[model samples]
Target: MMKILIIEDEPSVRVGLSFTLESKGHKITTAENGLDGIRIFEREGFDIVISDLRLPGADGIEVLKSIKNISPDTGVIIMTAFADVKNAVEAMREGAYDYISKPFEPDELLIVIDRFIKHKGLELENIRLKEEIRERERFQHIIGTSPAMQRIFETIEVIAKTDSSVIIYGESGTGKELVANALHNLSPRKDKPFIKINCAAIPETLLESELFGHEKGAFTGAVQRRKGKFEAASGGTIFLDEIGDMPLALQAKLLRVLESHTFERLGGNESLTIDVRVIYATRKNLKDEVKANRFREDLFYRLNVLPITLPPLRDRKEDIPLLVNHFLKMFGEKLEKSDLAVTPGTMDMFMEYDYPGNVRELKHSVEMAATLCKGTKIERWCLPAEIRGDGETPDAVISVFDDLPLTERVKTFEREAIRRVLEETHGKKKEAAKKLGISRETLWRKLKEHGFPVSPSDLEE
Candidate 1:
């Protein structure tokens, strides 16, 4: 129910309107004058405001302007015995929902109020939906539900509580930055800023100054004192991506900062202290870099204190269908359509190909399919050419020649097909059995007859 405020100088009219609105289940409050009405409006938020055109002291127009300035969304309806054309037009121009002449029927007032309430409901719902969309977009950076991801989640839970430096180890496109964000969101410092720097993206010559900041005339281009990532992320987290690409000489300075939580700006001897959490991520193996004396051993140990590794997509094939469904729902909502489901055949095709770019590549493929799929169901044809190629299909199971021992060859092929299906489906026995057009019991019997390995782990290379 909406809360409504009624402003009228006449005591009888004010009581009558309040009683009528209250009978309709709206919460009602009354003010004798426009000034009192504005005071009540400010102290308590109201969904709709009903006020007379004339009132003692501050008039209704002044009250309407004040209420609107405070909360523009509060619907205002103007009522006046003097039905001047100029007054009606000006009230509407001033953002009143509608103007009603005095001696208006109760039914007419009810109808107008009902319509305005309906419109307000729709507007609120739209705002809520937009907020939900924005929240989902923000969380889209982190996407995974595999065993490897579960472990990462556990690690994030533990590490987020502390302000310790972290080093994330993963291949390119493994969402290292997403992990960094998750850390920030889960930490007590969530309200603070999160600063990110890509060591490889910036030139080595400028990187030191970029990180440690610079004082005026520190270098040729240094015109004024500058704050760097550490200072910017003070009391927050700074994610240094591709830290393995940092120059060897700078590694010493970085190690000192990590050890002491202090650094000197370029050409400035004043030591600046920062209370920032440093999270580093790199595609290159730091252990190998340290062995080659390219990365500092002490720095490696310091950053690697709380390491999190993201597994590639190939190793977590079981998560593809889940990820595909998630992306389809996400894109469908973004495009203002009902959710689309991928066909089993399309899922089979996705399972067969090796995603070279891991989860990032899979997301791109799903987005492409969702865009191309005109129908509610996404088919194999909607998939990218690389994923839809003929080479990935199970044509080997199809007998081209009918000449050689038909029944025996067919049985052998069927068994092999079932095994291959099982492998592709990640040893979900029931799903594999269904895919092979056999009962679960029959698949189990066949597995026993063939002496197939009992453990699902045996299928992995």
Candidate 2:
């Protein structure tokens, strides 16, 4: 089943070896000398090469070196006499796969070849697994190509070089944690620990002790001393999610730590210093929180040095197709459903629907669809009921129609719908027209009439 090259000077030995290997079902190519063997190897691929330690033009070590330099993956077995064992050892040291003693039994040669084949199989499998992992994590787990996402990628690249605190603003389920991870991984402290704690998820009573460390017997449950997120993330990054929900009282202490990189553990006056980079994420607007007297003004400015606002899925819908494909491939492999895909109608519906729950929701929807998919492809009916507009009204726009006349309401809705679709498509008028169920010329005229921004070339039918 394997292609083997036999390079031996003795005609009798070469023929006998070829006969023995061929009888074992291996395809053997015989070469009279080292030079011919090297030439054959260069012209055609072989799984294993067997060469004598002593030869006329090029010796066994020379052949091994040449074969290794050409194809490192090819298994080379050096055949040497008892006295030439030293040279065979040198050949192995130079990268020969293994060495075989001359006048050895056919069983011995077969064993070495079998071992080499198994090892090569394992090596190839390892390479394949690594490539799969790389493909899945191509964008650090953040999948998108919309113009808004492109800008975010650029911003992350520019800011990752520094250790300044950053504030990421986005709606819930918009991958705020993913963005925080990307920033940490892209930064210099990537190798260090990255600790995360949801400010809103943890109770306000224990939030301070969670941010800083606690001494033994500090609180009712403090039976032992413990390090908190900042301590655990020293020399690394700490991601504080839903930071807008952090209690105002704790915000002052957080601001002190951000400004001075020092904080005292609860019930412990001794200040502990740490070199930790902070990344804050929030669904609520801190500016509004500040106006409402819920967030401190000075703390807002301290954390808002580098601000990043992630657009919602509805606002960057052009990336839906790419995200759909990514999740399909991702969950397809997980669910053992190879070659899984979405129908065109399903894809069109995805492009039209506004994802209020953002990328996280889209990912879950794809996962569920892939799980329930009976065929190789996911049909329109396989999608969630909400996506199919069966369970409820598609969006809330219809509720506001009572405030204006019928004509003005219809025109306003049309203009707003076109605008949102265009934004999702990244201003690609052709795709926008298709999603709107209209011709390119009609979409173009509507764009001009509604005063929507678009490229001139995009209007071409």
Most accurate candidate by TM-score:
2
TM-score of 1: 0.55
> TM-score for every candidate vs. truth?
0.55, 0.57
Model 2's alpha-carbon lDDT is 0.85
Across 16-63, the per-residue lDDT of candidate 1 in tens digits comes to 898888999999999999998999999998999999998897887898
How far off is model 1, as Cα RMSD?
Answer: 14.6
Model 2, 35-133: lDDT tens digits are 998999999979899888899888888899999999988889999898787787799899988887877998999999989888888988999989866
Q: Candidate 1: worst 10 consecutive residues by lDDT? A: 452-461
CA RMSD per model (angstroms): 14.6, 15.9
Q: Which residue pairs clash within candidate 1? A: none
Return the clash pairs for model 2, or none. Answer: 317-424, 318-424
10 residues in a row with least lDDT, candidate 2: 391-400
Cα deviation of 91, candidate 2, in Å: 26
